[model samples]
Target: MRISALLIDDDPILRSGMKGLLSMVAPEVEIVAEAEDVQSGIAAIEKWKPQLIFLDIQLNDGTGFDVLEHFTQSTTRLESQVVFITAHEQYAVKAFRFSALDYLLKPVDPDDLRSVIEKVKKSQDDATGISHVELLLENIKRQTNSFKRIALTNSDGIHLFEIADIIRCESEDNYTTFYIRNNKPVLVSRTLKEFEELLRDHGFVRIHQSHLINLTFLKSYVKKNGGYVIMADQTHLPISQRNKERLQELITKTL
Candidate 1:
C-alpha cells in the first residue's frame, strides 16, 4: 500500500529537506500536505487524513506535542502515526518511548532517514507499535526512576495513582482498569495486554487473559480445584493451568 504523509515543520529549509529525503527513500510514499504552525498543521490534517505524519517538535506558534493534542482531542482520534523530527535533546529519547515512531535529529541525514523508514516498515508489519512504545517508556522509567505514579483522568478531572498503590491491571473491553489502594479503580483507555508489557518489571502478572495482577500485592495462593491468587483486596484471580508453574516460580523468587 502506498503510504500518505503530512509534514509539520516551521523551518522551511528543514521541511524541504525531509520531504526530499522521504521522496527519495520511499518513492511509493507521497507527501499530501505541509504546515508551518500548529494551527495550520491541524487544519491540514483535518483536510487530508494521511497515514503518517512527520512532526517537528517546535513550531512557530506552539510545541509539537501541543499540535498532537489537537488531534488527540475529540476533534480527531489521531488516526495517523507520528514520527517527530526534533532538536530537543531532553524529549528526543522520551519521544521514541512515548511514540514508538522513529525520530530524526536536526540537520536530517539521509542515513537516519533510511533507518527510520526501515523502522516504520517493521512497525507496519508488527502491528504492535504501541506495545513497543510502552515498553520503551517503561524502560526509560526504570533508567530514570522518574514518576512512580500513573495519571488518570475522569469526568471530575485528573488524578494520580501511586504505582505502589496499584494491585494489578484488569481488562474489560478496550479499557484497562487499575486496581488501587482502597480506592475506586482508575479507568484508562488501553488494554490489559498493553499494561502487562508496560509493567513487566513492576511485578505485574497476566495469570489470566482478562486479569493482570501485581504479584507484589498478592497475599495468598490457593492450589485446590484449579489455582487462584488471593490479593490483599480479598479478590481472587484464577490462574490458568499453563501459567501456574510460572507464577509459582516468580512467587518463590519474590518471597
Candidate 2:
C-alpha cells in the first residue's frame, strides 16, 4: 500500500520545504493534507487517517504535545505513526523515547529522511499491517512530558538531574528548587525565572512565578481555590490569579 502522510508545523519555510523533501525522498508516500496548528492537524488526522504524520514539536498555536493529547484522548482511534521534525536540539533524545517512528532535526537532510522512511516501510512490511501503536500509546502519553532535566545543587557541589526522576520546579529566593520523584527539593544556582526561560521552548510553562510545572506531568487542577494545580506526584502548586487566564489558554491550546 502507498503510505499516506500528513505534515504539521508552523514554519512556512520548513513546512513547505519538508513537503517537497518528502515528495522527492519518499515518492511512494502520498501527502494527503497539511495543518499549521493543532486543531487543524487533529481534523486532518481524523479526515485522512494517514499512515504517518510528520510533526513539528512547536506550532504557532501550540506544541506537539497538544496535538498528541488530541490523539491520545480521542474517541476515534489514531493508527497513524509519527515522525517528529524539530529544530530544538534538546528534544531529540526525548523524541526517541516517545516512540516516534523517526525524527528529522531542522534543516532536514534528505538522506536521513529517506533512510528512516525505508526503515519504517520495512517495519510495516514485517508487521503484515499491524503496528505497535496500541501497546505503546500509554507509555508515550505518560512519559512524553515527564522527561525533565534539572540543575541540582547542595552544600557540596552541583549535579545535573536525571530527566525521568524529576517531580517539579519551584521558585525560591533567587534559585529554583527541583523536587525529585522521591527525594527532597534541591536548589539550583539559576533562578526559577532562568529555568522557566530555558524550558519554555521545550513545553514547560509557569503557572505561578514560584512554580514552573510540566503540563505533561499534570494530574489535576482546582478551579475554585484560585486554581491550584496538582501534579502527577501529588505536589500542589499555586497558580497566580493573574496568570490563570493565560494558563487556561495554554492548557486548551496544547491539548
Best by TM-score: 1
Could you list the CA RMSD of all candidates, in the order they appear?
Answer: 9.2, 15.0
TM-score of each: 0.52, 0.50
lDDT of 2 by residue, 1-255 (tens): 588889998877887888788889888888889999988998998899888888887888987667777655668776777777877555443434333235788789999999878866855522211122332333344444554343343443435555555557887788767776767677754587766755664556788878887777877778976779999878788899888888888889878
Q: Model 1: what TM-score?
A: 0.52
lDDT of 2: 0.70
lDDT of 1 at 150: 50
Candidate 1, residues 1-255, lDDT tens digits: the string is 587889999999987888788778777678899999989998887789777788887899987667765543444555666677878575355435333345778888888877776666645533222333344344344544343655454344345556678897788998878889879877866677767765666677889888888887899999987889899888988898888888999999987
Residue pairs of candidate 2 with colliding backbone atoms: 66-254
For candidate 2, the C-alpha RMSD (Å) to the true structure equals: 15.0
Best by lDDT: 1
